[model samples]
Target: MPSPPYPVNADGCHPDKGWTQRQAAAWLVQEESPTGEVGFVRSTAGFNGPLCEPLTVQVQFWRLTYRSAAGAQARGSTGSAPDYSFTMAAMKHVQLRVDGRRDVVVTPPKGYYSSHPSPCVGGLVAFYTGGPLTEKELPSRIVSGDSLLTFDSADFHTNRVIDSKLSSPSDPAVCDADGKPTRPTSAPSFPAGALLPTPSYPPIRLNPTHT
Candidate 1:
């Protein structure tokens, strides 16, 4: 199965937890396609009994295919231009509204906020980039955006911000009594207003899906 974009458990825990092909085969029924391709089969599938339920499931599919565990992703080099290259830029000073006060993280001029930046900020944000193209610096640029979404610090911090915002137990408006998100009244969102929720324990360290 394809990896989830969001967390699965109430604790912002992922049921898969970086399960490998062999490990996944232990929990799920593995099958070979007519073309000799290995995949998870829905019918007579293998899964842990009383499988942990998902807090939110987005875009369910009947079958999920993969070229390999991790598909091919191109990586570019530094200087001398190739067919494809990735330009690198460092973040200079940034301006934000902290608790309704205008706060700017400016250095002598174009310098990065080397300290830990706050997760929450509001109002105008000026992302000054592009200074001088050095091994570090680049030209000056600005990116402006309003609060796209908000999360409780606890919820936002859960699983490095990949946690679930909605309670795992079904919401009647979103699901039938059976616990399905048939018509969700409100989807999981970063806690918008005041409340900030934190995870109870330190989250587990997950391995990279690809070797």
Candidate 2:
């Protein structure tokens, strides 16, 4: 099984330790979804690099706590239970290279833990690229035909097929026509129009090694 970047607590809970600015930035990149489009108003305020860049990362652990009795029992509770939870780990910063793009060399960070991820680890790593526009913004692309690799691990290798991809906001201007102030619409929450497609590529495996 794969190991976590830092040892988890005895209760299998990830420590709530704070992360460095770079670490947090790396995590944000890893955490963003690989599908859909972000229409305009962007977050991830401080990062200024292109949407996609090589990532140096480590494994992170997460816990899912059941908030209701139905939720607890659905996971196979033996008896009536007020609450329940489960824990698992996932590797982040798994890099995906696009077709025809030049290769990138990403040095692994300290506390490197390389292994085939545990089967229990869930979700696809985020593949970042410039959103609909070229401004500094979060990744808004999907993994549709690229090769996913693991640079954080000691031995770099490749995973051939990405079985699945994991599957969010904004504001408006105050200007009006003819230099007249416009009134806000009474129904602020309406269905949005058809959206343009974000960049997409193929995927790879669970435990990535550099090829």
**Which model scores highest in TM-score?**
2
- The segments of candidate 2 whose C-alpha lies over 4 angstroms from its true place after superposition are 1-19, 22-47, 50-55, 59-82, 85-211
Instruction: Report the lDDT tens digits of candidate 2 across residue range 47-150.
Output: 22222333322221111111111222212233321221112122223333321123233322221212321111112222232222111121222111111331
RMSD of each: 24.2, 21.4
lDDT of 1 by residue, 1-211 (tens): 9543333455433355444434332333333222212233332112232234311111100110011112113223422111101111122222221111111122211111112211221111112111211221211211111123321111111111111111111122233222233453433422233121113222121112221
Cα RMSD, model 2: 21.4
Q: Show the lowest summed lDDT stretch of 10 residues, model 2.
A: 60-69
Best by lDDT: 2
User: Against the correct fold, how does model 1 do in TM-score?
Assistant: 0.14
* Candidate 2 residue-wise lDDT at 210: 15
Give lDDT for model 2: 0.23
